[model samples]
Target: MLASLLAGLGLGFSLIIAIGAQNLFVLRQGVRREHLVAVVAVCATSDAVLILLGVSGIGVVLQAVPWLLVVVRWAGAAFLLGYAVLAARRALSPSGQTLSVGTAASPPIPDAGGTALRTRTTLATTVLTCLALTWLNPHVYLDTVFLLGSVASTHGDGRWAFAVGACLASLVWFTALGFGARYLGRWLDTPRAWRILDALIAVVMVAIAVSLVLPH
Candidate 1:
């Protein structure tokens, strides 16, 4: 039981710790300190829910309906490509606040007047983006559902233990990533550093998009 649990934890961390769109977005939000809690909640909760569904044998049902994956593939690729273009623009643009960070990081609250309204709007947009990234990606289903589910099914009566371990792994990873990103804010204070980060994000997004459309 302990070995199964440890294996589950290790597998979960290995998958979640990879550099991906979801991680990139979460890191950016963490650095900006914008809706950090909401973003982390959405990511961690989504992973936990998916892991549960996988362990509960939903993976078999999904495999039987393979067409569902095709739809998700197209949608996810399009969304990723769009985000890549936006990131590239931010990297190239000279006079935008897209990637500008602060030397002293402090979470910005809704002030008075138009500023508060903008903040609310930005937060809403961020929340929506997080939802889309979590739900739309085909790789997420492939990893959390099909792959992890198959592995979990092998654990017999200890499947739930494995699932719990995976859930804990996701929670711990997101908590550390979302909270620890603030330390880099001081280094990213300059536009050059921000541009480099955005550029790297763009490259990753584009690579994922290509992989989604191309043959495996």
Candidate 2:
């Protein structure tokens, strides 16, 4: 039982620790300190839910209907491409406040006695984006649902123990990643740094989106 649990934890971390769309989004939100808690919660919870579904034999059901995955693939690609465009725009023209260590690049409002008004990404918008990043990616299903489930089945009666371990891994990873990036905000204080980050994000998004539609 202990071995199975450890195996699951190992596999879970291995799969999730890779640099992917979801991880990149989490890192960005963490650095910006924008709805960080909600974003982390959504990611962790979604992973848990998907892990549960996989353990419950939903993977088999999904495999039987391959068209479902195809639909998800196209939708995910479109969404990713859309986000890539937005990221590219940000990279090209960074207006308003950006991620900083202790200060934001807020613009002064003329009508408000020259007081700087810090604009932020709304909580609702952040949450929705987090959800889309989590659920829309077909790779998430392939990793968390099909791959994890297939591996967990090998543990026989100790599958639940493995699932528990995997769940814990997700929670721990997201919590650390979301909270830890705050320290790196200082590096992104300059517009050049911000542009570089956004450009990298756009490139990654486009690459992933292209890979999704390409023939395997």
Candidate 3:
């Protein structure tokens, strides 16, 4: 049982920590200290739910309905392309938003009676973007439902244990990534670093979008 759980945990971590768009977005938010908890919760929860669905035989059902994938594939491709453009614009014009760890340590300052409203708006926008990043991507379904689910099924009765282990892995990873990224705040304190990161995000998004549409 321990071995099965460990296998699931290890595989889950390997799949998730691959520096993809979602991971990058989470890390960026973590460093910025903006809606960190909501971002982590949504990502980890989404992973857990998707992995369990896959392990519970939804992968087989998806295989039976090929049209679903076709719809998802095109939709995901469109989303990714749109995100890539945003990333590219950001890269060209760095925001310098996350470069200062000082702002977080300091107490809140009066801001024309608009800070609270802005905070609420920012939080909502961040959560919605995280959701799109998590759910709108076809790769999530492919990896969590089809790939991981098929692999879990091979474990027979141990697949449930494996699913639990995978869920734990998601929790561990997103938690670490969301919080641990704060430490890197010291390193990413420059416009150059932010620009480079955004550029890389653009490249990654465009590449993945192309892959989604290309014949496989």
Each prediction's TM-score against the native? 0.88, 0.90, 0.85
lDDT of each: 0.83, 0.86, 0.81
* Pairs clashing within candidate 1: none
Candidate number achieving the greatest lDDT relative to the actual structure: 2
Worst 10-residue stretch by lDDT in candidate 1? 112-121
Which residue pairs clash in candidate 2? none
Give me the overall lDDT of model 2.
Answer: 0.86
Per-residue lDDT for 23-89 in model 3, tens only?
Answer: 9889988876778999999999999999999999988888999989888888888887898898787
**What are the per-residue Cα lDDT tens digits for candidate 1 across 1-216?**
887788789899989999999999999888877789999999999998999899999999998999999899989999999999988987886743433332333222332431321112266788899988888899899889878888999999888888888888998998899899999978876667777888999999999888888987
**Between the candidate structures 1 and 2, which one is better when assessed by lDDT?**
2
Q: In candidate 1, which residue ranges exceed 4 Å CA deviation? A: 96-121
After superposing candidate 3 on the true structure, give the runs of residues whose Cα lies further than 4 Å from its correct spot. Answer: 94-121
Q: What are the runs in model 2 whose C-alpha is more than 4 Å off?
A: 94-118
The order of the candidates by lDDT, greatest first, is: 2, 1, 3
